[model samples]
Target: MILNNPSRKEIKNVLDHAKTIAVIGLSPNPSRTSYIVSESMQRAGYRIIPVNPRADTVLGEKSYASLSDIPEKVDIVNVFRRSEFLEGIADEFIKIDCPVFWTQLNVVDENVFNRLADVGYTVIMDRCIKVEHAILK
Candidate 1:
């Protein structure tokens, strides 16, 4: 079956309870959307963990090569990758303690969404986390 995005109420609940967000495909470049969105979220009081293999650090936090490399529990896994790259990260997402898997605007895949939902993850696709936080919180 297909999975739908959590309700605004549910999204707010997740954002309210969440503290740390693991940003997959985050870039060190300030001009990138991931960096911009992540920075905005960081300023809004959520800890941002950059999960990029090419960068050692970003926005003052030590970057991990992958989600599995992060030493702490993650509240959210915010992805900034194309749909084709999503399958590669599914394993790490499931291995972590993240409750939410949020994809940035324009990034989406139905099969992946359904699979994550089947495994009990709250998945949000093609939405901006920063925008949601600003509107819903």
Candidate 2:
């Protein structure tokens, strides 16, 4: 199946309408891109759910051990894990039914992309949400 990757316009719409973002694999280190990006989104008034088993908290919010652990609905699932581990994350993502499944820059898996697309998810691979948000907002 040909996956419908979000166009720039579609991405903009998604970013514009999204209220909460679940950042999978968010690191506690302030220098990490995930940390910085999530912080920026939070400052912009988007609720950021930091998902990282190793981290207890980030950006002053309690970190969820996994996507399944998040209590509230997540509009976007921004993945920070490597390509090798994406399938597992995708598995978790499918169970939760997030509208957006975004794989961070340089992370891609064709099989997972196909799977997510088949399920009607708007998948964005190898794109930085922070950069997109800066440009779109």
Best by TM-score: 1
TM-score of model 2 (CA atoms):
0.94
Score each candidate by Cα lDDT.
Answer: 0.91, 0.89
lDDT value, residue 126 of candidate 1: 86
What would the per-residue lDDT of candidate 1 be over residues 22-86, giving only the tens digit for each residue? 99989999999999999999999999999998999999999999899999999999999998888
lDDT at 96, model 2: 93
Alpha-carbon RMSD of each model: 1.5, 1.9
- How does each model score on TM-score? 0.96, 0.94
How far in Å is the alpha carbon of 93 misplaced in model 1?
Answer: 0.6
Q: Candidate 1 at residue 10, lDDT?
A: 94
What is the TM-score (0 to 1) of candidate 1?
0.96
Clashing pairs in 1: none
Off by over 4 Å in 1: 1-3
